[model samples]
Target: MDTTALEFSLPNAAAEPDPFSIADLSPEIRFAVLFFQRDHYCTNCREQVQAVADRVDAFRARGAEPVSVVPEPLDRVEQWQAEYDLPYPLLADEDAAVGDAYDQPVRFGLLGSVSDFLGRMPQIVVLDRSGGEGDPEVVYTYSSNSTFDRPSIDELLATLDDLAADGETTSTDG
Candidate 1:
Protein backbone atom coordinates (compact mmCIF):
# COMPACT_ATOMS: atom_id res chain seq x y z
CA MET A 1 0.00 0.00 0.00
CA ASP A 2 1.12 3.58 -0.62
CA THR A 3 0.39 4.55 3.02
CA THR A 4 0.50 8.26 2.17
CA ALA A 5 -3.28 8.37 2.52
CA LEU A 6 -2.92 7.44 6.17
CA GLU A 7 -1.77 10.92 7.10
CA PHE A 8 -4.56 13.17 8.42
CA SER A 9 -5.44 16.26 10.44
CA LEU A 10 -8.18 16.31 13.05
CA PRO A 11 -9.36 18.07 16.19
CA ASN A 12 -7.30 17.26 19.26
CA ALA A 13 -8.08 17.47 22.94
CA ALA A 14 -4.44 17.99 24.03
CA ALA A 15 -2.15 19.70 21.60
CA GLU A 16 -0.53 23.13 21.32
CA PRO A 17 -1.70 23.21 17.72
CA ASP A 18 -5.31 22.61 18.93
CA PRO A 19 -5.95 20.47 15.84
CA PHE A 20 -3.59 17.49 15.61
CA SER A 21 -2.05 16.12 12.49
CA ILE A 22 -0.49 12.67 12.46
CA ALA A 23 2.28 14.02 10.26
CA ASP A 24 3.33 16.33 13.09
CA LEU A 25 4.86 14.53 16.05
CA SER A 26 7.98 14.62 18.19
CA PRO A 27 11.17 13.66 16.40
CA GLU A 28 11.70 11.16 19.19
CA ILE A 29 8.42 9.49 18.34
CA ARG A 30 9.70 6.78 16.04
CA PHE A 31 6.50 4.81 16.34
CA ALA A 32 2.95 6.16 16.45
CA VAL A 33 0.50 3.79 18.13
CA LEU A 34 -2.83 4.72 16.60
CA PHE A 35 -5.70 3.29 18.62
CA PHE A 36 -8.73 3.49 16.32
CA GLN A 37 -11.98 3.35 18.19
CA ARG A 38 -15.27 2.00 16.79
CA ASP A 39 -17.30 4.81 18.31
CA HIS A 40 -17.99 6.73 21.52
CA TYR A 41 -20.40 4.14 22.89
CA CYS A 42 -18.09 1.17 22.60
CA THR A 43 -17.22 -0.21 26.03
CA ASN A 44 -14.23 -2.04 24.66
CA CYS A 45 -13.01 1.14 23.04
CA ARG A 46 -13.35 3.02 26.33
CA GLU A 47 -11.41 0.37 28.24
CA GLN A 48 -8.73 0.30 25.57
CA VAL A 49 -8.51 4.09 25.76
CA GLN A 50 -7.89 4.01 29.49
CA ALA A 51 -5.49 1.11 29.15
CA VAL A 52 -3.40 3.04 26.67
CA ALA A 53 -3.57 6.11 28.92
CA ASP A 54 -2.22 4.09 31.85
CA ARG A 55 0.78 2.99 29.81
CA VAL A 56 1.45 6.04 27.66
CA ASP A 57 4.72 6.56 29.51
CA ALA A 58 5.88 3.05 28.76
CA PHE A 59 5.16 3.58 25.08
CA ARG A 60 7.10 6.85 25.09
CA ALA A 61 9.94 5.15 26.93
CA ARG A 62 10.21 2.77 23.98
CA GLY A 63 10.23 5.66 21.50
CA ALA A 64 6.54 5.33 20.69
CA GLU A 65 3.61 7.71 21.26
CA PRO A 66 0.11 6.30 21.73
CA VAL A 67 -2.60 8.28 19.91
CA SER A 68 -6.28 7.51 20.35
CA VAL A 69 -8.52 8.26 17.38
CA VAL A 70 -12.21 8.40 18.16
CA PRO A 71 -14.46 8.25 15.09
CA GLU A 72 -16.83 10.75 16.62
CA PRO A 73 -17.25 14.51 16.58
CA LEU A 74 -15.07 16.95 18.54
CA ASP A 75 -17.60 17.40 21.34
CA ARG A 76 -17.83 13.68 22.07
CA VAL A 77 -14.09 13.31 21.92
CA GLU A 78 -13.75 16.19 24.38
CA GLN A 79 -16.03 14.39 26.80
CA TRP A 80 -13.72 11.41 26.73
CA GLN A 81 -10.73 13.65 27.35
CA ALA A 82 -12.47 15.34 30.26
CA GLU A 83 -13.19 11.97 31.80
CA TYR A 84 -9.93 10.15 31.13
CA ASP A 85 -7.53 13.06 30.84
CA LEU A 86 -5.44 11.11 28.39
CA PRO A 87 -1.75 11.92 28.65
CA TYR A 88 -1.33 11.41 24.92
CA PRO A 89 -3.13 12.81 21.90
CA LEU A 90 -6.87 12.26 21.62
CA LEU A 91 -8.08 12.92 18.11
CA ALA A 92 -11.59 13.22 16.69
CA ASP A 93 -11.88 11.56 13.31
CA GLU A 94 -15.34 13.04 12.85
CA ASP A 95 -15.94 11.65 9.38
CA ALA A 96 -13.96 8.42 9.95
CA ALA A 97 -11.93 9.15 6.88
CA VAL A 98 -8.78 8.12 8.68
CA GLY A 99 -10.28 4.82 9.72
CA ASP A 100 -11.35 4.03 6.17
CA ALA A 101 -7.91 5.03 4.92
CA TYR A 102 -6.35 2.57 7.34
CA ASP A 103 -8.78 -0.13 6.15
CA GLN A 104 -10.69 -0.61 9.39
CA PRO A 105 -12.86 -3.55 8.33
CA VAL A 106 -16.62 -3.84 8.10
CA ARG A 107 -17.61 -7.35 9.17
CA PHE A 108 -21.08 -7.77 7.73
CA GLY A 109 -20.54 -6.06 4.42
CA LEU A 110 -23.38 -3.68 3.56
CA LEU A 111 -25.29 -4.31 6.76
CA GLY A 112 -22.25 -3.61 8.90
CA SER A 113 -21.43 -0.52 6.89
CA VAL A 114 -24.67 1.09 7.95
CA SER A 115 -23.84 1.35 11.64
CA ASP A 116 -20.48 1.87 13.34
CA PHE A 117 -21.80 0.30 16.54
CA LEU A 118 -22.99 -2.95 14.98
CA GLY A 119 -20.14 -3.50 12.54
CA ARG A 120 -17.09 -1.26 12.79
CA MET A 121 -14.25 -2.93 14.64
CA PRO A 122 -11.28 -1.65 16.61
CA GLN A 123 -7.83 -1.28 15.09
CA ILE A 124 -4.29 -0.37 16.05
CA VAL A 125 -1.81 0.88 13.54
CA VAL A 126 1.81 1.46 14.52
CA LEU A 127 3.39 3.91 12.13
CA ASP A 128 7.17 4.15 12.05
CA ARG A 129 8.80 7.43 11.15
CA SER A 130 12.40 7.34 12.30
CA GLY A 131 13.36 10.79 11.11
CA GLY A 132 11.98 14.30 10.55
CA GLU A 133 11.34 13.53 6.82
CA GLY A 134 9.50 10.89 4.79
CA ASP A 135 6.12 9.24 5.24
CA PRO A 136 5.64 7.02 8.27
CA GLU A 137 5.74 3.35 7.30
CA VAL A 138 3.01 1.00 8.40
CA VAL A 139 5.14 -1.23 10.55
CA TYR A 140 2.36 -2.92 12.44
CA THR A 141 -1.41 -3.26 12.20
CA TYR A 142 -3.97 -5.15 14.27
CA SER A 143 -7.56 -5.21 13.11
CA SER A 144 -9.98 -6.76 15.53
CA ASN A 145 -12.20 -9.50 14.10
CA SER A 146 -14.73 -9.07 16.89
CA THR A 147 -15.76 -6.16 19.04
CA PHE A 148 -14.22 -7.71 22.16
CA ASP A 149 -10.96 -8.70 20.54
CA ARG A 150 -7.84 -6.63 21.20
CA PRO A 151 -4.18 -7.21 21.84
CA SER A 152 -2.73 -6.44 25.24
CA ILE A 153 -0.46 -3.45 25.77
CA ASP A 154 2.42 -5.75 26.71
CA GLU A 155 2.14 -7.40 23.31
CA LEU A 156 2.41 -4.04 21.57
CA LEU A 157 5.44 -3.12 23.70
CA ALA A 158 7.04 -6.39 22.78
CA THR A 159 6.55 -5.52 19.12
CA LEU A 160 8.44 -2.24 19.66
CA ASP A 161 11.17 -4.12 21.50
CA ASP A 162 11.47 -6.60 18.67
CA LEU A 163 11.66 -3.83 16.09
CA ALA A 164 14.43 -2.11 18.03
CA ALA A 165 16.24 -5.38 18.51
CA ASP A 166 16.10 -5.90 14.76
CA GLY A 167 18.03 -2.61 14.32
CA GLU A 168 15.04 -0.63 12.97
CA THR A 169 15.17 1.96 15.75
CA THR A 170 15.21 5.38 14.09
CA SER A 171 14.42 7.66 17.01
CA THR A 172 16.78 10.61 17.35
CA ASP A 173 17.21 13.59 19.68
CA GLY A 174 16.79 16.45 17.25
Candidate 2:
Protein backbone atom coordinates (compact mmCIF):
# COMPACT_ATOMS: atom_id res chain seq x y z
CA MET A 1 0.00 0.00 0.00
CA ASP A 2 1.09 3.56 -0.72
CA THR A 3 1.93 4.97 2.72
CA THR A 4 1.24 8.49 1.55
CA ALA A 5 -2.45 7.67 1.39
CA LEU A 6 -2.59 6.63 5.02
CA GLU A 7 -4.36 9.13 7.32
CA PHE A 8 -3.52 9.58 10.99
CA SER A 9 -5.13 11.26 13.97
CA LEU A 10 -3.29 12.03 17.18
CA PRO A 11 -3.82 9.38 19.85
CA ASN A 12 -5.44 10.11 23.17
CA ALA A 13 -2.64 9.88 25.65
CA ALA A 14 -4.95 11.34 28.31
CA ALA A 15 -5.55 7.85 29.67
CA GLU A 16 -1.96 7.77 30.83
CA PRO A 17 -2.09 11.32 32.26
CA ASP A 18 1.23 12.20 30.73
CA PRO A 19 2.30 15.86 30.46
CA PHE A 20 3.62 15.23 26.99
CA SER A 21 1.52 16.41 24.11
CA ILE A 22 1.82 18.21 20.82
CA ALA A 23 1.66 21.37 22.94
CA ASP A 24 4.07 20.25 25.65
CA LEU A 25 6.62 19.11 23.13
CA SER A 26 9.29 21.62 22.21
CA PRO A 27 8.02 23.36 19.16
CA GLU A 28 10.32 23.04 16.20
CA ILE A 29 10.23 20.75 13.26
CA ARG A 30 9.38 17.50 15.13
CA PHE A 31 9.26 13.89 14.14
CA ALA A 32 7.02 11.29 15.82
CA VAL A 33 8.59 7.84 15.82
CA LEU A 34 5.75 5.38 16.31
CA PHE A 35 6.34 1.66 16.75
CA PHE A 36 4.03 -1.18 17.71
CA GLN A 37 5.61 -4.19 19.32
CA ARG A 38 3.58 -7.27 20.13
CA ASP A 39 5.75 -8.70 22.88
CA HIS A 40 8.87 -6.56 22.79
CA TYR A 41 10.70 -9.79 22.10
CA CYS A 42 12.20 -8.95 18.77
CA THR A 43 15.93 -9.62 18.63
CA ASN A 44 16.54 -6.46 16.65
CA CYS A 45 14.44 -4.24 18.90
CA ARG A 46 17.47 -2.71 20.56
CA GLU A 47 19.28 -2.23 17.31
CA GLN A 48 16.28 -0.59 15.69
CA VAL A 49 15.86 1.76 18.63
CA GLN A 50 19.52 2.72 18.42
CA ALA A 51 19.29 3.25 14.70
CA VAL A 52 16.37 5.58 15.32
CA ALA A 53 18.25 7.38 18.06
CA ASP A 54 21.15 7.90 15.72
CA ARG A 55 18.78 9.41 13.22
CA VAL A 56 17.29 11.57 15.94
CA ASP A 57 20.76 12.83 16.72
CA ALA A 58 21.18 13.86 13.13
CA PHE A 59 17.92 15.79 13.35
CA ARG A 60 18.98 17.35 16.65
CA ALA A 61 22.19 18.55 15.07
CA ARG A 62 19.90 20.40 12.66
CA GLY A 63 17.73 21.68 15.58
CA ALA A 64 14.88 19.20 15.22
CA GLU A 65 13.62 16.92 17.99
CA PRO A 66 12.56 13.33 17.42
CA VAL A 67 10.10 11.76 19.84
CA SER A 68 9.78 7.98 19.86
CA VAL A 69 6.42 6.49 20.83
CA VAL A 70 6.44 2.79 21.59
CA PRO A 71 3.48 0.62 22.56
CA GLU A 72 5.07 -0.98 25.55
CA PRO A 73 5.44 -0.69 29.29
CA LEU A 74 7.68 1.82 31.02
CA ASP A 75 9.95 -0.99 32.11
CA ARG A 76 10.38 -2.19 28.57
CA VAL A 77 11.07 1.31 27.38
CA GLU A 78 13.58 1.74 30.16
CA GLN A 79 15.25 -1.52 29.28
CA TRP A 80 15.48 -0.46 25.66
CA GLN A 81 16.79 2.93 26.72
CA ALA A 82 19.59 1.40 28.77
CA GLU A 83 20.37 -1.18 26.16
CA TYR A 84 20.36 1.25 23.28
CA ASP A 85 21.68 4.25 25.21
CA LEU A 86 19.13 6.49 23.53
CA PRO A 87 19.38 10.26 23.81
CA TYR A 88 15.74 11.08 23.03
CA PRO A 89 12.74 10.50 25.24
CA LEU A 90 10.67 7.37 24.76
CA LEU A 91 6.94 7.48 25.48
CA ALA A 92 5.22 4.36 26.74
CA ASP A 93 1.85 3.30 25.37
CA GLU A 94 0.90 0.46 27.67
CA ASP A 95 -2.51 0.02 26.12
CA ALA A 96 -1.41 0.50 22.54
CA ALA A 97 -3.90 3.34 22.42
CA VAL A 98 -1.50 5.63 20.62
CA GLY A 99 -0.61 3.00 18.10
CA ASP A 100 -4.24 2.28 17.42
CA ALA A 101 -4.87 5.98 16.89
CA TYR A 102 -2.45 5.85 13.98
CA ASP A 103 -4.27 2.80 12.63
CA GLN A 104 -1.30 0.62 13.44
CA PRO A 105 -2.63 -2.86 13.84
CA VAL A 106 -0.98 -5.54 15.93
CA ARG A 107 0.71 -8.18 13.80
CA PHE A 108 0.43 -11.85 14.68
CA GLY A 109 3.30 -14.16 13.90
CA LEU A 110 3.82 -17.68 15.25
CA LEU A 111 2.96 -16.21 18.62
CA GLY A 112 -0.20 -14.77 17.14
CA SER A 113 -2.16 -17.86 17.96
CA VAL A 114 -1.61 -17.35 21.67
CA SER A 115 -0.99 -13.63 21.76
CA ASP A 116 -3.25 -10.81 20.62
CA PHE A 117 -1.41 -9.50 17.60
CA LEU A 118 1.95 -9.08 15.93
CA GLY A 119 4.20 -6.08 16.14
CA ARG A 120 3.50 -3.04 14.02
CA MET A 121 5.79 -1.64 11.39
CA PRO A 122 8.17 1.15 12.22
CA GLN A 123 6.56 4.39 11.08
CA ILE A 124 7.54 8.03 11.21
CA VAL A 125 5.21 11.02 11.26
CA VAL A 126 6.94 14.31 10.55
CA LEU A 127 5.12 17.37 11.86
CA ASP A 128 5.97 20.93 11.00
CA ARG A 129 5.79 22.33 14.53
CA SER A 130 4.67 25.64 13.09
CA GLY A 131 1.76 24.25 11.12
CA GLY A 132 -1.84 24.73 12.24
CA GLU A 133 -4.06 22.14 13.97
CA GLY A 134 -6.41 20.86 11.28
CA ASP A 135 -3.75 18.53 9.89
CA PRO A 136 -0.03 18.66 10.44
CA GLU A 137 1.71 17.96 7.19
CA VAL A 138 2.82 14.34 7.14
CA VAL A 139 6.22 14.84 5.57
CA TYR A 140 6.84 11.12 5.36
CA THR A 141 5.50 7.65 6.27
CA TYR A 142 6.88 4.12 5.91
CA SER A 143 5.64 0.59 6.30
CA SER A 144 6.85 -2.07 8.79
CA ASN A 145 9.34 -3.43 6.31
CA SER A 146 10.58 0.08 5.72
CA THR A 147 12.83 -0.36 8.72
CA PHE A 148 15.20 -2.23 6.44
CA ASP A 149 14.20 0.10 3.64
CA ARG A 150 14.53 3.06 5.99
CA PRO A 151 16.44 5.97 4.68
CA SER A 152 19.85 6.69 6.06
CA ILE A 153 20.25 9.25 8.83
CA ASP A 154 21.88 11.64 6.43
CA GLU A 155 19.06 11.34 3.93
CA LEU A 156 16.36 11.81 6.58
CA LEU A 157 18.15 14.84 7.96
CA ALA A 158 18.46 16.42 4.53
CA THR A 159 14.78 15.84 3.87
CA LEU A 160 13.83 17.47 7.17
CA ASP A 161 16.12 20.42 6.46
CA ASP A 162 14.36 20.98 3.19
CA LEU A 163 10.97 20.82 4.90
CA ALA A 164 11.96 23.23 7.64
CA ALA A 165 13.44 25.64 5.14
CA ASP A 166 10.25 25.51 3.14
CA GLY A 167 8.13 26.10 6.23
CA GLU A 168 10.17 29.13 7.28
CA THR A 169 9.70 30.75 3.90
CA THR A 170 5.99 30.01 3.81
CA SER A 171 5.39 31.20 7.35
CA THR A 172 7.22 34.45 6.63
CA ASP A 173 5.13 35.03 3.52
CA GLY A 174 1.90 34.57 5.44
Candidate 3:
Protein backbone atom coordinates (compact mmCIF):
# COMPACT_ATOMS: atom_id res chain seq x y z
CA MET A 1 0.00 0.00 0.00
CA ASP A 2 1.15 3.51 -0.79
CA THR A 3 0.88 5.11 2.66
CA THR A 4 1.86 8.42 1.18
CA ALA A 5 -1.54 8.55 -0.49
CA LEU A 6 -3.50 7.88 2.70
CA GLU A 7 -5.07 10.79 4.60
CA PHE A 8 -7.23 10.89 7.71
CA SER A 9 -8.28 13.35 10.42
CA LEU A 10 -9.72 11.91 13.61
CA PRO A 11 -10.89 13.38 16.93
CA ASN A 12 -7.86 13.04 19.15
CA ALA A 13 -8.61 11.61 22.58
CA ALA A 14 -5.25 12.32 24.12
CA ALA A 15 -3.12 15.39 23.44
CA GLU A 16 -2.52 16.96 20.02
CA PRO A 17 -0.99 14.30 17.72
CA ASP A 18 0.07 16.37 14.74
CA PRO A 19 -2.74 14.43 12.99
CA PHE A 20 -1.67 11.74 10.52
CA SER A 21 -2.62 13.23 7.18
CA ILE A 22 -0.93 13.49 3.77
CA ALA A 23 0.66 16.73 4.89
CA ASP A 24 4.22 16.83 6.14
CA LEU A 25 4.64 15.87 9.77
CA SER A 26 6.22 18.11 12.40
CA PRO A 27 10.03 18.41 12.21
CA GLU A 28 10.62 16.51 15.45
CA ILE A 29 8.61 13.43 14.66
CA ARG A 30 10.73 11.04 12.63
CA PHE A 31 8.25 8.24 12.58
CA ALA A 32 4.55 7.80 13.38
CA VAL A 33 3.76 4.37 14.80
CA LEU A 34 0.06 3.78 14.16
CA PHE A 35 -1.55 1.01 16.23
CA PHE A 36 -4.83 -0.23 14.72
CA GLN A 37 -6.73 -1.76 17.60
CA ARG A 38 -8.84 -4.89 17.33
CA ASP A 39 -11.76 -3.43 19.25
CA HIS A 40 -12.81 -1.49 22.33
CA TYR A 41 -13.09 -4.54 24.57
CA CYS A 42 -10.12 -6.68 23.56
CA THR A 43 -7.96 -7.48 26.58
CA ASN A 44 -4.94 -7.99 24.40
CA CYS A 45 -5.42 -4.55 22.92
CA ARG A 46 -5.66 -3.07 26.40
CA GLU A 47 -2.50 -4.79 27.53
CA GLN A 48 -0.70 -3.79 24.35
CA VAL A 49 -1.69 -0.16 24.85
CA GLN A 50 -0.59 -0.14 28.48
CA ALA A 51 2.72 -1.68 27.44
CA VAL A 52 3.21 1.06 24.89
CA ALA A 53 2.34 3.69 27.48
CA ASP A 54 4.98 2.29 29.80
CA ARG A 55 7.73 2.53 27.21
CA VAL A 56 6.66 5.72 25.49
CA ASP A 57 9.90 7.43 26.41
CA ALA A 58 11.90 4.82 24.55
CA PHE A 59 9.88 5.58 21.45
CA ARG A 60 10.51 9.29 21.88
CA ALA A 61 14.23 8.71 22.23
CA ARG A 62 14.08 7.08 18.81
CA GLY A 63 12.10 10.01 17.36
CA ALA A 64 8.95 7.93 17.13
CA GLU A 65 5.50 8.70 18.53
CA PRO A 66 3.04 5.89 19.10
CA VAL A 67 -0.59 6.61 18.20
CA SER A 68 -3.43 4.23 18.94
CA VAL A 69 -6.46 4.25 16.62
CA VAL A 70 -9.70 2.92 18.05
CA PRO A 71 -12.56 2.20 15.66
CA GLU A 72 -15.23 3.42 18.04
CA PRO A 73 -17.17 6.53 18.96
CA LEU A 74 -15.56 9.56 20.61
CA ASP A 75 -17.02 8.62 23.98
CA ARG A 76 -15.48 5.15 23.75
CA VAL A 77 -12.05 6.56 23.03
CA GLU A 78 -12.51 9.13 25.78
CA GLN A 79 -12.99 6.31 28.24
CA TRP A 80 -9.66 4.91 27.09
CA GLN A 81 -8.07 8.29 27.63
CA ALA A 82 -9.47 8.48 31.17
CA GLU A 83 -8.19 5.02 32.01
CA TYR A 84 -4.80 5.01 30.33
CA ASP A 85 -4.11 8.73 30.43
CA LEU A 86 -1.84 7.99 27.51
CA PRO A 87 0.92 10.52 26.97
CA TYR A 88 0.61 10.10 23.22
CA PRO A 89 -2.33 10.50 20.91
CA LEU A 90 -5.35 8.24 21.10
CA LEU A 91 -7.60 8.66 18.06
CA ALA A 92 -11.29 7.98 17.57
CA ASP A 93 -11.83 6.45 14.17
CA GLU A 94 -15.59 6.24 14.52
CA ASP A 95 -16.24 4.99 10.98
CA ALA A 96 -12.99 3.00 10.65
CA ALA A 97 -12.25 4.79 7.39
CA VAL A 98 -8.63 5.34 8.39
CA GLY A 99 -8.24 1.71 9.38
CA ASP A 100 -9.82 0.64 6.11
CA ALA A 101 -7.54 2.99 4.21
CA TYR A 102 -4.55 1.38 5.90
CA ASP A 103 -6.08 -2.04 5.18
CA GLN A 104 -6.24 -3.20 8.81
CA PRO A 105 -6.76 -6.95 8.70
CA VAL A 106 -10.17 -8.63 9.01
CA ARG A 107 -9.85 -12.35 9.63
CA PHE A 108 -13.35 -13.87 9.74
CA GLY A 109 -14.97 -13.42 6.33
CA LEU A 110 -18.50 -12.21 7.08
CA LEU A 111 -18.34 -11.99 10.83
CA GLY A 112 -15.16 -9.92 10.81
CA SER A 113 -16.51 -7.68 8.06
CA VAL A 114 -19.58 -6.98 10.14
CA SER A 115 -17.88 -6.51 13.50
CA ASP A 116 -14.47 -5.07 14.32
CA PHE A 117 -14.31 -7.11 17.52
CA LEU A 118 -14.78 -10.41 15.71
CA GLY A 119 -12.57 -9.79 12.69
CA ARG A 120 -10.23 -6.86 13.04
CA MET A 121 -6.67 -7.85 13.84
CA PRO A 122 -3.86 -5.58 14.96
CA GLN A 123 -1.75 -3.45 12.59
CA ILE A 124 1.40 -1.49 13.38
CA VAL A 125 2.41 0.85 10.60
CA VAL A 126 5.61 2.93 10.87
CA LEU A 127 5.63 6.04 8.77
CA ASP A 128 9.02 7.60 8.10
CA ARG A 129 9.11 11.37 8.20
CA SER A 130 12.89 11.68 8.27
CA GLY A 131 12.81 12.97 4.74
CA GLY A 132 12.31 16.52 5.95
CA GLU A 133 9.76 18.77 4.21
CA GLY A 134 8.16 15.87 2.34
CA ASP A 135 5.08 13.89 3.31
CA PRO A 136 5.94 10.96 5.53
CA GLU A 137 6.10 7.60 3.77
CA VAL A 138 5.21 4.17 5.00
CA VAL A 139 8.58 2.61 5.80
CA TYR A 140 7.36 -0.49 7.61
CA THR A 141 4.05 -2.31 8.11
CA TYR A 142 2.96 -5.14 10.43
CA SER A 143 -0.53 -6.56 10.06
CA SER A 144 -1.33 -9.19 12.67
CA ASN A 145 -2.71 -12.60 11.78
CA SER A 146 -4.57 -13.20 15.04
CA THR A 147 -6.03 -11.50 18.11
CA PHE A 148 -2.93 -11.91 20.29
CA ASP A 149 -0.49 -11.57 17.43
CA ARG A 150 1.17 -8.19 17.58
CA PRO A 151 4.63 -6.68 17.77
CA SER A 152 6.28 -5.90 21.08
CA ILE A 153 7.51 -2.44 22.05
CA ASP A 154 11.12 -3.64 21.81
CA GLU A 155 10.47 -5.03 18.36
CA LEU A 156 8.84 -1.77 17.34
CA LEU A 157 11.89 0.06 18.66
CA ALA A 158 14.16 -2.16 16.62
CA THR A 159 12.20 -1.38 13.46
CA LEU A 160 12.53 2.33 14.18
CA ASP A 161 16.22 1.86 14.91
CA ASP A 162 16.54 0.11 11.58
CA LEU A 163 14.72 2.94 9.86
CA ALA A 164 17.24 5.37 11.31
CA ALA A 165 20.10 3.08 10.31
CA ASP A 166 19.06 3.17 6.66
CA GLY A 167 16.30 5.23 5.13
CA GLU A 168 13.30 3.86 3.23
CA THR A 169 12.94 0.23 4.29
CA THR A 170 9.41 -0.33 2.99
CA SER A 171 8.07 -3.74 3.89
CA THR A 172 4.35 -4.54 4.02
CA ASP A 173 4.95 -8.08 5.28
CA GLY A 174 6.45 -6.97 8.57
By the TM-score metric, which is better: model 2 or model 3? Answer: 3
lDDT per residue as tens, model 1, 2-22: 554367888898543567876
Q: What would the TM-score be for candidate 1 when compared with the true structure?
A: 0.90
Candidate 2 ranges beyond 4 A from true positions: 1-19, 29-39, 105-119, 132-135, 167-174
Summarize candidate 3's per-residue lDDT along 36-123 as a digit string, tens digits: 9988898899898899999999999998888899889989988988999988888888888899988899878999889887888889
Poorest lDDT segment (10 consecutive residues) of candidate 3: 17-26
lDDT of each: 0.81, 0.52, 0.82
The better-scoring model by lDDT among 1 and 2 is 1
Candidate structures ordered by lDDT, highest first: 3, 1, 2
- Among all candidates shown, the one with the greatest lDDT: 3
Comparing candidate 2 with candidate 3, which one achieves the higher lDDT?
3
lDDT of candidate 2 at residue 110, scale 0 to 100: 47
Clashing pairs in 3: none
Evaluation by TM-score, superior candidate among 1 and 2: 1
User: How large is the C-alpha RMSD of every model relative to the true structure?
Assistant: 5.0, 7.4, 2.1
